[model samples]
Target: MKAKLITLAVVVVALGGGIALASASSEPGSGPPAIGVVRAVRSGTDIVLPFDAYRHTPAEINVIERATAVLARDCLNRFGLHWAPPTVDAVDTSRPTAAGRYGIVDAAEVARLGYHAAEPPDRPSQPQPPLDVLMVYTGKGASDVGGQPVPEGGCLGEARRRLEEGLPAAMPGERFAELDRELYLTAQADERVQRAMTGWRECMAESGLRYADVWAANDDVRWSAPEPTPEEIATAKADLACRTRSGLAGTWLAVETAYQQRVISERRKEFDALATALHARLAHARQIVNR
Candidate 1:
């Protein structure tokens, strides 16, 4: 029997509202001045996880999926069966997607897609192979066919093993969650961030969208409707406009960054260890993809 291959998707959402002042480039002598003691510790490198390394970039995800798919295809082909590879896209990590970020900044997007994420592009369907073939691919035990025992760990497992060799078994986001929490707490307590929040609230009130804060605006009952109503759309647009007018986003980002730098300085040793581990993992991932 062929094994049924299970594909896992890893999603990472960045927390905190800091502006990244340092150059993201690993190279020295590039971009703006490094921020504070954190920069001193790592030189020019950014302390936070790089967008590509946060979870898996679309490309990295595709590589792993393609590797497994190829293994499945080859295994099935041996028995005169056919299989198809999975399609993937690199994740977009450029901007924050948190509900509190600008309180639905993209008005046009909200009007078009509402609160839901855009539907992924559909792919052509492929033929399913026989149960035995699936069992072998999935690593589920089944009686040997053609007097050959199924490969240990199935082809899918073997493919994953190869792609993930030397990588941490746990998801990277989990490890970074602690850092994110600390940064978030610091931002909440920051007087500058609080001032920005107050200004944002006043701006919203001017637009007749009275809300306590971004969180209140986001959690408004009007948005709970099955589809976005006209009022919801209008409020969302006004919310974003007010946020911009108040310069809340920029202020929050700057304050968050400052707080994060402080935290990084205090936790220098821990962050340094994390940075080293992440660098090694990323290098290993690049090797796998290139090979």
Candidate 2:
């Protein structure tokens, strides 16, 4: 529960550049039109349609670009108005402006389904609030990797440091120990925390590790015995479980290879799936239009 959510939050923030900070002014007029879903009948009452296709993929991005182009051109053609694409820094998909809201149609698909077609759906006179578009590239590939070269606030190393310092304390009585044993430690060890651990390790390797430093910390390689007692093994397992649940596993095992590889692989797949789906939806429109 707590552990998993924290880990997930970290992963998302790492990949997506942190929880998006709300700006004082993300006015739609100054930003990209935020798209929302609309349920409407296209042709006969027989054909019900959802005008917004929520696909986030390369193909979907293309659809967005094409649709925007068509809409912009149409608005110009019909209403004698032109709109500039919003700048990247101003894109705030989480919160869109109302006045700048644009109604994005799947165009050809909407027309084929019997929705009244606007040769260009981008009409300033349509009375529909202006809408800026958001095209997201999603899937496994978009997951975060700590070692990848990023600007200062992005390294896994920094994340690890913060994790060690402590996250906002969990609700009272919900110590890392209790959370790990009760909710986070997957029965199979292959389920949740283990995978996160793998991701952290990969981040370390990518960032480069110092064996001397690691050995110095352990002291066992140079001064103590290599084998751990049964009690030590049990302690280690418990510790790992505790760390995983707390989202501290990545910071703890920042040196392990197996863990990091798994994390990276998982994120890649997530992004890939998102991209694939977006492409499919866009292709759907193309099929109808070409027909």
Candidate 3:
């Protein structure tokens, strides 16, 4: 069966309110500029950015401020931009039905393992984290330029409505309008590591190899350590050596390198093999489709 991937998008707006709060310095490589998340509150021709509810990184905060500056400079660019911290959406991977609903690993071992996926937040009329900077257009030029009042909503709502209604009728230019929410996310080495890990797990499970300790460490383990310490590097090298000695090192290294490169082409190779096996098993298992 072909894999299925589902991605849901939401839109919310910032809300009225002001409160002062603070946090300690963010860990290096923790996330992007903004400390928390950001959402836009729409009222009339005015757009207010509320930053009170969501957690943000310094990079995330910086991006928001810079984006806001661009908007102001360009007369409130009405494009959707989303800011996200380090996160992945939670997913169920134990069954075949899920293949069509989310990105599937296809291998039974990966199904036993779980994952979380992060999404861009863009809604109107929703509570937003406190703002590092609130953007309110208090001028007559916006109205004079034919800027229509965004119906009451948060950043997400506005994004949805914009998609459904099409860009504002009076948009300065057709190209000036967009519907997809803007996202500010952290840059990582890439998903090559994850894909490689998935393949390794699947291969081990198929061979009846019981490596639960290794399994547990990879599943849902956040990269809390910003920089790899000498000890960590030595550990990785040792682990690779063990896998090599065990004849699985080639597979592990390939996946690891791909992950570092921000790509996981090998994962597809693994997925294809697992999918074929699953097809044969399900044919004889007499399982219901949607139970």
Give lDDT tens digits, candidate 2, residues 128-212: 3232211011112323333332213322233223322322211111221232232222221433434544553444344342222
RMSD to the hidden true structure, all candidates: 10.5, 25.6, 23.3
Sort all candidates by lDDT, best to worst: 1, 2, 3
- 69-168 per-residue lDDT for model 3 (tens digits): 3333233244232333212222222222112221222222222222222222543343342231122233322222234453233333333233223211
TM-scores, one per candidate: 0.59, 0.20, 0.22
**Total backbone collisions, model 1:** 17
| lDDT top scorer | 1
**Which segments of model 2 are wrong by more than 4 Å?**
1-56, 81-192, 195-284, 287-291
lDDT per model, in order? 0.51, 0.28, 0.27
Tell me how far the alpha carbon of residue 241 in candidate 1 is from the true structure, in angstroms, after superposition: 2.0
- In candidate 1 the C-alpha lDDT for residue 277 amounts to 46
**Highest-scoring model, TM-score:** 1
